[model samples]
Target chain A: MSDQQQSGGAAVASSPPVGETLMEVTGVSKVFGGLVAVNDVNFIVPRKAIVSLIGPNGAGKTTFFNCLTGLYRPTTGRVNFDGTDITAKRPDIVTQAGIARTFQNIKLFRTMTATENVEVGMHPRLRSRVTGMILRTPFVRREEKAARERAREILSSVGLKRMDELAMNLPYGDQRRLEIARALASEPKLLLLDEPTAGMNPQESEELRTLMERLRTEQDISILLIEHDMKVVMNVSDHITVLDHGEKIAEGSPQEVRQNPRVIEAYLGSQA
Target chain B: MRFLASLRSGRDTVTGMIPGWVLAVVLIVFAVIFPYLVGSGSFLDASTQTLAYVIMALGLNIVVGFAGLLDLGYVAFYAIGAFVIGWFGSQQFPDVNGGKGIHILASDRATFQPKLSGGRLDIAGIHINFFIVLFIAMAITALWGVLLGAPTLRLRGDYLAIVTLAFGEIVPRVFENSTSGLFGIGSTDFSHGRQGITPIDKINLPWSHDLLYSDANLKPAYWVALGMVFFTIFVNRRLRDSRLGRAWIAVREDEVAAASMGINLVRTKLWAYAIGAAFGGFAGVFLGTYNNTVNVDQFEFGFSVFILAMVIVGGMGNIWGVIVGAVALSMMNRYGLPQLNSLSEPLGFDVTSISFGIFGFFLLIMMVLRPEGLIPSGRRRLELREAEIEGSEDTGAVGDMSQMYEVRQ
Candidate 1:
């Protein structure tokens, strides 16, 4: 989106100087039948920042996320990630290219254990083809051992010490964290958490916010969170973008977005 | 009863005091000498055939159970493999060797010898050894697997099953119809019409006489087939733990999510098909050698269904389940039908003629009584249990069934 205080017919606020853009979305629009779900939205996520996307329900926040992640090809514009024009790339290719994501609904492999889910995320990093697997070659064995060790490390770090418990059997809060841990296993340059703390307790949400901050600093991974909880969003995000009716309405630092009238007007209208 | 219990709990008996591997070693020793213990060549022959079926069923399980792809035409691979042996091992094409039979791999192979005539029988062209033909069968079948897997990449569930079924039907028909070359391309006869390529060069070692002609010494075939079963089990176990195996399960669980995890759907599915087909070829080559023929009649839609039934009746993803299913179904097909004949003989009906119908009944019972099969994987078992709970109409029937587990209180 534009860095200007008021540009693209939407209210905006300037943030501090940001790094090289990791993701630059330029004039992206996604249309479904007759509805413009994501209507010409320009968005940017700078390197190593926790960005929150806040909008009312049906504001096409998820649709925009899908576009960036390559689930839905942007019908009209380009998405560039790490200098690669990744517009309309396949979802798996997007993952392989190091943009990992967790679904809003917690898409952990239900029957598989938490560790197994995380191991799946590690698939892109690990390379053991069928021949090596069948032969149990030394390199394959070493890779497997290292992968399992990495899984144990990731699981414990995410506070999921019981790696054997099935993802579905894990508690709701743990399951959400497990999903994050699974995404983290991919070693992505950017992670998109789609309302991860939804249906979580206040303490759980606070814990997730802390985890998000830690992930950004420790792993050098950028975070793009979609959240309704203003407390977590305002406290955790370096930048916040507000959307209304499939269009960008406000963009700024937390303080600047908090003072932006357009954002408040959109939320109030939706709530009313 | 005490004796049976003592035998059952080997760990409790004097033998039970031994370590697990010791017990396994003892079992291996027993298996090695099993043919001599039985002393019946016909029984050993039947057992060897069962082993071949077991291998085929295990292969089909990789696709259907592990990958969650319904394959109705797995027998096409079997046909391809058998044909590989038929083309490579037998004297089907006399033009290849200038009308002289050539022995390959087996230095002692009686060239074109259909019977123990104590002399090399002059027959058609190429009479390659069985060992070389076996690998060729596997390679060709694996290639067919990729071809079959490619078209079904976009297909799912019933559509996938239908496409596979069409393939299964087509392969056999092509073999049956092609009395000449493939679509009449050449003058070479591939299968020799309905007569089939006869007396498929017996499995002769460079060191020993051909097993088929070695005075009913079926031991070699038994040991070899058992070795194959063990090989299959080892490969299947390795695959189940590997990255590809995980991808198979992931794709089975949620294709979109798997794709998002960077597991290429086509690659994962193709591996399943290729691996499964390779084994089918392995068994096909074995069966062709053992049966002494690879007729188009043997490679039918019914055989595909039979193997699929074994996978389903055995628990789908569970390796042991499929083995048990394959062995159980195959043995039943071989031995059980004949036993039914004595019972049906009094009623003046030929049970032998209706043996297939009996198999259909067994399948029907299996589906209704245990949809999850004999030894279901942990995930499938739980999913089935949940579905049962939600559907509660079966609760009453399940309760009645559960009472069977209650002791003689």
Candidate 2:
């Protein structure tokens, strides 16, 4: 197959229409003994939209993200992703089912090269088995070459340089971008980013915000962002869900959620 | 400062001067002609044994080094491999199919049994070809590897090491005691008890009528071992660069991140164990055939540690490093200690008696001075020095949340 066909066909540039639910989390509650991490959280990510889940510390934003991504089995809930119930599936199965995620702390394969980290993300998609790998059959060789090329393309697309550098050796901001590049390598329908811009400078965060927009509009991917940076959340989110101590207290467009009294109270305190 | 500079660029000077493939070719050519150059039968025999150890060390490197699974009982696979040859390549089983031995693709020499039924020559045991038995050993050991690895899926670090250690210990004892077959269920004798199976069929190609080199020549055995080592190296390099290899590394790096990336941790790790054990078995068959014995005494815990030391000392996760480690350690045990015996004789001491103690000291020094090994993989080196490098670079990094936590406290 031609290089264009390999990288282009899978991810067509046509943006998915809005209002179609890419992921629907209904009545999803996670109970760790008596402590309720995520309590009956009903959430939806529209197609090709950058949806934000924002809250104060201990508000279960990351827990809710984990439930959506199949990292944690919800105590009571159903997570339907793109018309399939992916509730309580293994993380690998969830990724195979077209949902990919980045961690709160950068979890790039530190020992591996930047390209290798991305290639690993392409694991679920590649079909070369052990025999083929050992023999280096033409099919396996072709597949491996294509995966490397695509990894390079994804890394470049994410605005990352130094493709040969170790993931741990890359600058902190580049590490964050590499994480997204890796997540993108899985060809996920829904992308979950946990604090993607946590330690980035304002300039880097701005670039990431633009990249998130491009990912939605150009790649037809839906993003579920759990971020503390209100500027990024308010700027990129098509819709926002605000949680306070495990319960969803507010939900609407950025402006509406920003103006909500309960959202302000959650962020500030009861007196506010 | 000069010492540190040399340490950093020492490996690079040789590697950078010659292309990697060229270096590999030179090594291969040297290895091919080594038996002739050595000439002495004892030295060739020791070299062959060292090559077998190389295969085993490379095998263990797969699980312990690449996949970061500490396997303390790698000798279990070795025991299984040796026994495979003992069962299939020996006259351990006398009564099979009414005493007409099951011989499949075996050499004519191996098929010839004593005269029976009016002076008619007949085979009386299962005599499979050496090459076929090698594969069988690998397959059986791989299956056992998966089975043993299944229970340790949830285990990590010390717990995983302990479980594998138990398995390693149990297999050899079982073979030693299973004189009346497993659990005394059948009349089939698994092992010939403590005496072990000896005088196993010699190695021969199915097509070649003449017996392959044995104790008298030893060159053929050395060549065979060298060939297996080459195969093991080829397989190891391929697996290290393949998709499954990447998955193994990812799992080793961070299980949660790897799982999130859609890598099946269970299967990836099991593949490491199975492939690792298969190589162990591959070498085991060769060692058994070459030594002309499959004794339970050979599969001891110390042997497992011996192989592990090769991996650790040579450099874990580096194929060439492991091979060097195996050769160095095996030669030290074989030639170095014996050579040292002459010096120690007048002093009324033996170096071989305190070999393990010396080895322990060497390991402790390696751990303290160069924990990654004498030659570390590039990735491992980076990991070992991550703190040093990171501290120097990326000072612009923010989010020192630990300080915040301390303030709150």
Candidate 3:
């Protein structure tokens, strides 16, 4: 753990320049039949920045996240990731092009071990096909071994200790961490986490916040988060975008968004 | 229920006491010497057939068990496999080369087409080596599996099963009706109608001077079947641990998450079908040669269900479990049912006649009692039991609403 911390700290100086755009979302909207879930929302995540997408219930935070991840094709807009026009591309293609996401509902492979889940996230990065796998060629074996090692490293980096435990069998907090670990295994340029600390206690959420920062500083990866916990959003997010009823109500630093009258009204209602 | 629980615990203890590799080694050793141990030729033949079923079950396990794709038409691959051997290893096409025949690496015994005026053996029909034909069967069946699986890529669960079931039902009929021609495309006799293809060449190696084995000696056949089983087990084990295997399991667990992880759903599912079908074909060739016929009557819906039962009973996704399931169910079908026929006088009905009924009942009981299967893989066992133990607390719902709404007292 200390070794990982040291490596993480060492890479801080090498992290990408702040304010450089990593992912650009322009005029993105997702409509489910008659209901407009996300409406003309333009968003951006700067390089090595921790950006949070925050909103109340039914605020279209997840819907916009889905559009960005390619899980839901946007009714209108373009999502350029690291200068690649990845709008409407398949989710796998999106992951391959260096964007990995976690589900709001914790969609880890329930039966697979923590390590196995991470290895699967490394699918796009893996080159071993059927013949190589069946043959267990030297190269494939090496690749598999390296993958297992890397998976272990990623798991530990996310503070998950049990590598062999099934994802479903893990504690709720651990399962959430495992999801992050899985997303990290893809080595994505941008990591999109949906409700990373949904069911966590304050302590667990704090640890996740730290992990998110460490991921940005140490790994030089941009983070796009959909978080319900305001404390976490305020403490960790480099920038915060507030949405309400399928529209972007406010976007700025945590303090700016917190003071914005529209954002305040959207949360506590018009009276407040 | 208590007795069953205790029995399961005891079984687990016994199995867990020995290391897995030791058990595997012992089982393989027993399989290798099985032919010598069994005195009766018919028993040996049945064992060989059982081995063939093992291959088919393992194959089906790849699709239904590993990938979680319910393929009800696995017998289609079996039919294709059997016909591959039937076409390549038999005189099904006597009209090939104007009755002079085409022979490739086939022994003289296999090429009894016609005797020329100079007393030379004039080979007739396509006679490829058994090994080559086995590979051909695998390739063709894999292609067919992909073709059959392509249309069902967008389907899931019952809908997918229904389409596969339709496929399983259609393939045999096509082969059966193609005796005069393939869908009236040509006058080529495909299956020889309901009569099926017969007199398939005996197992002969390209390098061998004579036939490797004949009807009189069943030992060689048993050994060959055992060899094929080993090959299947090896491939299955390797695949279960590899990159592709993980992708299949991930897809099975959750398609959306798997896709999000960058696992290609189309290629992964299709490979499951192809590889699974390839194994079916792998065993089909052996069964065709051993049974001495490629009959459409054998490729029934019940057969697909029978293979599926093996995968389910053995524990879907567990290689050893599926093998055990195949052996138990296959042997019961061959020997146990016939033995039960003696009690038919008292029972007032033939037991063999209601074999599927009995299987269905057994499956019903198994699902209720031990849905994870007889020898479920570690992960699968956990998944089923976990679902039972943990209800909906993971769904973000409060487990204790009373605490959340406690009175001000």
Candidate 4:
């Protein structure tokens, strides 16, 4: 597809507004044993934009996400989110710093109801103390009610309005959507979706694409997504970063990266 | 149509409410009527003893069930609570000033004397009220829990279990050995030793004015213990439903996931240990008062293992399961084995052999057949069944659920 068509016919009449800079990773390096899982990576993600990080298998896309999200601290370099140094912060701290994420594998509290699962995401947001909870005080009751309402809204937005259903009972596509809804319930300034459309049909992927577009425009939140499907990535992403063997090979608009010979070679060689 | 639909949705919203409310009412009712049904006096005694175990089990549940922390030294807290109370409530120096007593509670009276007879010591000078001693015992035991919990929370699984077991063994030994020289009440030669602190003053009530020392009965003690148990159940239920409780369960289910969500691992784990230890402390006070004696033998490793077994056999992570386990196991230890021994004695079988043999056999059967315990936690039961079914289905190929999902995909 041409660069103009790939922009989804929403190309800026005036230049796409330079939104806030939400995440800035500067020269991050992560070495495991003798091998570099992530080598000297540098990137910037702007607020309210869907930025896609795509690479062939073993490209360290997931590793880089892990470092950024505080699961694995980078051996070198710094990660700044909203003016705070979050490089060595624990995952919970990183999450509390306004970044929420979904795993490549669904990690919903499987036994918990869909609503309860979403409520867990709203854990940091809830303002009930242990003492208040034990006493079942008025404040706790009110806070619980508010949390349930917020959970319901998030679930309904993701098209799983029946919140009483167990998370594992949801079909694959809805589960994926529920995961997104959960991430959103954390009320994060940035949402990291790892293979958000993985294991979904074309129709589901198409719906997710529209959802991404709507979330970007209306939710006032940035998205950093790792997706294997080129069609979905190219369709939704305003910009794309390509990685190969733990190295950032190219980064630009989707059209530019797709046209890059090195990016093409990386995929072709991996397939062979 | 929207109104009717909304009303139906509202009804569904309160789905978890009915059972919870019903259970609460039933428990409250049982607590009120149980004393009378069990013949106020004898039933009270048994119930008081049960209450002590209930509290201890609740505490242990937080560690083993909520946080998945296995502690085999929980009885240490019990020892600390009882000893602290024993030290203060009883006068140890009767012959200190040539037949004049030095009482721990008050040393105002000159005619007060400490009485010692038949290897048991009694303080005739000053006696602290039972309720006051119970509170003091709980505080002392909780401090011990923190002391033990701080160093061991860093250790995981079997290592943690072993360290706690050693601590449990050492605390009572120290208490039994160290009460003589520094205290000046008992000489180095005159240690409480293995026989333990005896002639502990029975619990007295202001209401039972003339009947104060009539009999070491369990009625009043039972009421106090019942109050504490209900209080524990209420507190634990709230903790389970709160953010901290959810964090604890998350850690138990998946520590990595829990940490990823920003839960401070050390803080969460410490809280579990502290809360669990606190319960053990409460139980210690009740136990000391129930027997009217504080003995080192009572808080042994066997008792710790018994409490752990109760948590496991009842159901880990489930409150009701812990209660059921505590009551069931307590009955087995206190009543069932003794009854069996009496019956087997006439049938030409040794009491110890028959009792232990039956106990060991029952435990073995339980492990092999129902590893998840009688009322296994919902998640545990599901995982166990899923694993078993999966294992049986794949006799030739050993592959897990993730691999199966991959193959199907």
Best by TM-score: 3
Candidate 1 residue-wise lDDT, B1-409, digit = tens = 4753454366347545778778768867976788888875778888888889989999999998889999989889888888888887877887776676566654335454546445554565676777778778888899899998898887776788899999999998889877878877986788887777777777776566544344357788898888888898889989999888888888887666676677677788998999899999999998887788889899878889899889988889998789889988888888888898898888999887876677688789877777788767888776677566767755654464343112110
Instruction: Output the number of the DockQ-best candidate.
Output: 3
Per-residue CA lDDT of model 3 for B236-319, tens digit only, reads: 999999999999999887777888888888899999999999999999999998888999999999899899989999898899
Q: What is the docking quality class of candidate 4?
A: acceptable
Instruction: List, residue by residue over B1-409, the lDDT tens digit for candidate 2.
Output: 4674597697688888999989988988999999889985788888989999999999999998899999989999999999999888888888976777777667666544443446443467778888999999999999999999989987877899899999999999999999997767786888988999876778888787457885578898888888999899999999999998899889877777898999998899999999999999999998888788999999988788889999999989998888889999999989888798888899999888887777787789888778788677877777668745677443432233221111100
Query: What CAPRI class is candidate 3?
Result: acceptable
Clashing pairs in 1: A1-A42, B10-B16, B11-B16, B94-B125
- lDDT against the true structure, per candidate, is 0.81, 0.86, 0.86, 0.74
Worst 10 residues of 3 chain A by lDDT: A8-17
* DockQ per model, Cα: 0.34, 0.37, 0.39, 0.24
Q: Comparing 1 and 2 by lDDT, which wins?
A: 2
When summed lDDT is taken over every stretch of 10 residues in candidate 4 chain B, the lowest stretch is B400-409
List the candidates' TM-scores in order.
0.89, 0.92, 0.92, 0.82
Off by over 4 Å in 3: A1-18, B1-4, B15-17, B113-121, B346-348, B390-409
TM-score of chain A of 1: 0.94
Please state the i-RMS of candidate 1: 13.9
